[model samples]
Target: MANQYDRNPFAEEEEVNPFANNNTGSVPAASNSRLSPLPPEPVGFDYGRTVDIPLDSDRSASQNLKKKEKELQAKEADLRRREQYVAFATYLGLVLCLFWNIIAITTAWIKGEGVTIWLLALIYFIAGVPGGYVLWYRPLYRAFRTDSALSFGWFFMFYMLHIAFCVFAAVAPPVVFKGKSLAGILPAVDVLSGNTLVGIFYFIGFGLFCLESVVSIWVIQQVYMYFRGSGKQNELRREAARGALRAAV
Candidate 1:
């Protein structure tokens, strides 16, 4: 209502933008982000770099592990083959010993002088052969196949007992340990003057027992040395301790 150019000293002054373009509209903060492009990344920045760094050491270590695994497999295979050969020899010996013992016992029965020995031999054959296989030989085989320390321990224990039995048989003592021997050296000598055929059978039986004892001793030595070298004793102790703990639990 006042004059158009007149100034009101009590009124607030409006700000003037020296460089503002009249054609452009005011932008809001939220809309500014959408309107503007992101700043360009530095020339050699690691923004686009992959997360995983390729390392030669990691690749080489993996290769080495695979190589060791292969070598171990090859060694185990060779050991298995050697064990097979030994097992074959052992089987042959067992069969021969049993066969010879049978022949000796049969000869004793026919002669009638060593029928008591024949009875003992019959029991021994029935129990010993199968017991040897189940108690010792199979355990030995399993130990080799599985690399089981426990199985090896069982084999050693039973095989030692078998060796002792072999020694007793070779001695051929009469009336000792339920007549363990078929026709020991004593009977062979006693009957030699009277019956040549029976004496020969008895002597041969004694000799075979001696041979078996020697072979058993040798085989045990070989197996034991290998077992020790393989460092299975520590593993055996660990397994035993674990078993005890489990039992307690």
Candidate 2:
């Protein structure tokens, strides 16, 4: 019974140690001693240590300038071409009008047709209105400003004036022939008497056409000036481009 109790006593008490859970304590300390030293922190960057870039400031500037010059030259060339085209077209139109006038005069002379003359005079007046604005004023104004040439304000003003002139012309014949006969079934006497008023219209229209012609001459001179100026600008641009190219090289 004593032996059995002693055996049981030995089985009842198992040793409980809290320090057994910390088996790596001395091993961690010994391993830390064997570890390599940590790397040092990097100092602040040295900005001035960079290599010098071989940037040719003059060469780059010249290249950019040459590109700009070429663009300007191209634009000027296009403008010159457009100007030549416009000039040629204007001259062609003038020739056509001249031919038209000749034909109208010839027909009127051959037939002694007063109506033809009246019609021609009316056409002359219509043409002269625009011609006056275009030939006399527009070119000189464009020469100074260069921007007003494409503006429609002047054209619009001329159109309004033309309409007013037409209204006046329409009313004048009736006023002139107010008391005339209505005979010949087509207002013949009125139509015939209208010619008397139209005779005055012819004088006015002829004077305007002459003025317009003078203006056209002046406009042509302005166009010539533009051409000359454009040529000089082109030469200067070419020279500038050559200088830029040489500098780049």
Candidate 3:
């Protein structure tokens, strides 16, 4: 029974330990042996190492250029082969003309008439073979080879005349100009009643002439269409302008 005023109510009470003085079995402290060594400083990355990468620009460019060159060569070869058909057609027409004239000469000789016409035909044959190549075929060939619009224009002019010649030679109208027409369809039809053999020869000649005419017509149409469709007309104008400028200069 202590006096109430002598007790301080805010003071903490002291805790008592029952085993403070007991030393027969003691607890051990926590050990660091089982804890893992902070995982070995995470091995620093080798940022200083450098790697080289190769980019062969020149090799790539050379390969690309070679590929383009091959393509161009193939295209040019195809163009050459394609354009040569027209030349071949021209040669064929000339050969047919040669044979047709020969037949005409033989027929005239057999008939013992039309000597003047056969002489004229002989002269044409002598000139036309080489002349055909030089005049029309050569120009067209040069136009194809060099892409020359002037050459194309020359070919057109000469080839048109050639086509007209073929038509007249094929039809063989009466010689209003000079002599009886070349041995052609009309002449063959006229001679058929008299000499069957001569008429047959004339018809053969007429057939050759007609073949030549047809070939000439087809070639001219094809070439003219190609000229128009392939924009060569524009090129022709440009070339003309260039020539005029050069002449003026």
Candidate 4:
């Protein structure tokens, strides 16, 4: 019998392919035309490159400004101390002069020495120079230098008042005495007895001294307040900037 399935000579047993229909190939030799060496690796863009720029100038400027501020603060403190010391010294000097006047007046009264009284009055008049320098000139100088509210007008007005009072003291007795040593003695005694006119003069002088002292103390307080306020504000600003820098870091 002739078999239905026959090994055809042309087929030669249909040589089997191990990878038949698997879509597996030699990958077309990785065509140089299509691959093109990966486009030279894209030049390796870096996001963390450090840039060099000189910040020393800016840093130096900031440091210099801080130093200048510190220097100014130190100077202000020194000036305030000096002003207070001078004020205390002047107060002491004025008190001493007051004592000297009191002694001279008592001696003149007890001894009834007219020449001595006149000499004492002259000494009081001369004492005005030191008093005026302390109460008027020095204070005004400090006020101007410190840009204080204690104005030259305040000094001038008080100084004029002092001068007017002194003039009254000098002339009042002569006018009231009327060329009699006994009359001079009576007027002097009236002053010691607390006559209304003499009392008023004393009150005005005391008021002027009190006003000067008050103004000086007020100015010192104002300077201290300003410095403290500025320091607090600067500290707050510096702390805020530091917080921002820390966050970035």
Candidate 1, residue 19: Cα displacement in angstroms equals 91
Model 1: which residue pairs collide? Answer: 172-184
Q: Which segments of model 4 are wrong by more than 4 Å?
A: 1-53, 113-156, 159-249
Better model by TM-score, 3 or 4? 3
Query: By TM-score, is 1 or 2 better?
Result: 1
User: Where's the lowest-lDDT run of ten residues in candidate 1?
Assistant: 175-184
lDDT per residue, candidate 1, 14-120, as tens digits?
Answer: 99998986755575445454566789975787778788767988999999999999999898678767765675476567656766777876776777644665666
Question: TM-score for all predictions?
Answer: 0.64, 0.36, 0.64, 0.34
TM-score of 3: 0.64
Off by over 4 Å in 3: 1-76, 176-181, 241-249
- Report the alpha-carbon TM-score of model 4 versus the true structure: 0.34
Better of 2 and 4 by TM-score: 2
- List, residue by residue over 32-143, the lDDT tens digit for candidate 3: 6586666656565878778665568778988999999999888766755665686577667676776676776667666866566666777778777887888888888888
Candidate 2 lDDT tens digits, 1-249: 356544564466778886775677655554354667899988877876887656798789889999999999888667656654554444444444434443433333344444544454456546764674575345434443453432323433443443344334323343323311111112223333545433333333334334434444444454556645645445545666887999999
Q: Looking at model 4, which ten-residue stretch has the lowest summed lDDT? A: 176-185
RMSD of candidates 1 onward, in order = 18.4, 14.2, 11.6, 19.1
Clash count of each predicted structure: 1, 0, 0, 0
lDDT of each: 0.77, 0.46, 0.76, 0.52
CA displacement after TM-score superposition, residue 69 of candidate 3 (Å): 9.0
Q: For candidate 1, what is the lDDT? A: 0.77
Distance from true location, Cα of 199 in model 4, Å:
26
